[model samples]
Target: MHNSIERTPIRAHLTDHMVIVNAQAVETGPTRRPAAVLIWSTTDQKIAFSDPKGNLLFEGKAALVAPEVIRRLRTTDSTFFSLNFEPGNRHFLPLSRLVARQDFMPLKFDRFSELSDELQSRFELADYKGIEELSDELALTLLPRTNAKHLRDERIDLLLPLLESNQPPELNSLAQMLHLSKDRLSHLFADDIGMPLRSYVLWRRYRRALLALQSGEKIATVAHRVGFYDHAQMSRTFLTLFGYSPSILKCPKFIRISGIQSN
Candidate 1:
């Protein structure tokens, strides 16, 4: 069976230190294991993923930790649907660290509660192919606006230039362009974006890796293309930041790999 595949969402550089991505797929496919997000709660240490869902798989909604969390579970056979979200706010989560498997507390926003009653009633929202456009609007608009904070707004501004780039940007250069020292950038990044500068870079690198894999390039080739010295480094980075090996994902189905880990 084939599903219509749109390019993945433009990687987001949120000022809120929140991470959001949008994708859609049928729940059944190969081994279906790929990278996973490591969400650490800067406040509590155990962060939670939104529930696995869709009329495509099971009923209602469920939550899961993928690639890395599952790997740590030592089982390779289980599969589930997932969409990633890690957010930080002082009044809300008050998180200080962004990371993978961080043992921070798990947090979730009210599901349909945020959506209108009409949209909420549509229980069987099939696949991402169906809802990605709406999801993008939410990620760019609703999610950032979720926590009204100046720090988060600044992080979005910091990401503006990198988002406009044709390739991965040198963080230092981006820092210079923004006229802040790397150390200041680090503080501002965590304050404004909720994640450290390095974590966001890794997230962008993996996004490129997903594109390369989807286009039929070798992981090693994609690794080099995205600034890793080699496939091994990429793999290691994937393991550390995302919780899965680079080899786990197939072309264009980056949905298999999940979550955004804040450094």
Candidate 2:
């Protein structure tokens, strides 16, 4: 099994709701991500995931892993794609339900084969618009069409902008603004957003930092702008959540990052 990060350039597509990475090869050590991740082999080869101790957890063409599930991926020379959904994204709740509290769930390829092929082609061509459209379609295909309703809560809606801002409100301040006790607000947020409020806030900060770094902002500047106390803190968070040090961004040969253009 390959044990080091692939040296070939990988493509990364980023948006507010999700991130898509397409790679020709990958071998990651144990990683526990903050957002839900769906990984599949584009060449239809089976990928192997194992625990830190080398115990086999899953072997399949595709798998949806829940947030905070630690696993390592090892694959042969097959093309691979991964889609990561932020906790507060519209598609997150539906996808989480599919996992249903399990560490990981295997998915059938017949349903996603055609769409995945198109998405991989778009990625290779760097077609951002096509990539965005196909990503939503692929997400929808994974969900139960009959039950895919947009989840909205007015209270939660009011809080999102504030949390995404440079100076996010404290939990107590947010609770007061929503006119609910702290505990009540927390529960309501979890129900509507599919994650606790604190986790969502951290994710927002991380997302913002990632975008800034991709645009060539210095690490320390990004840390301060995104509410981290210092560059070290931000780097540590990046390592924990993404399984890589933020310093990796300095090497342009490793990956190419692009964001979806706003409509």
- Candidate that scores best on lDDT: 2
Across 66-161, the per-residue lDDT of candidate 1 in tens digits comes to 332322211111221223433233322221222234432233434323442322232134333333333334333323345544445555475654
Query: Which stretches in model 2 have alpha-carbon errors above 4 Å?
Result: 1-6, 148-150, 260-263
lDDT (Cα, 0-100) at 159 in candidate 2 = 86
Worst 10 residues of 2 by lDDT: 1-10
lDDT of each: 0.40, 0.78
Relative to the unseen true structure, what is the C-alpha lDDT of residue 153 in candidate 2, on a scale of 0 to 100? 83
Q: Alpha carbon lDDT of residue 223, candidate 1?
A: 77
* Deviating ranges (above 4 Å) for candidate 1: 1-80, 86-158, 163-171, 241-243, 251-263
TM-score of each: 0.49, 0.88
By summed lDDT, the worst window of 10 consecutive residues in model 1 runs over 72-81
Please provide, for model 2 over 1-263, each residue's C-alpha lDDT reduced to its tens digit, 9 standing for 90 to 100: 34334466667788777888887666666777766788888776888888879899999998888877888878777878888887777888788778867778988877666677788778778787888777777777778769758668899988887887767889999999999999999999998887788888877787777767766778898889888889998888887776666777545676677784311
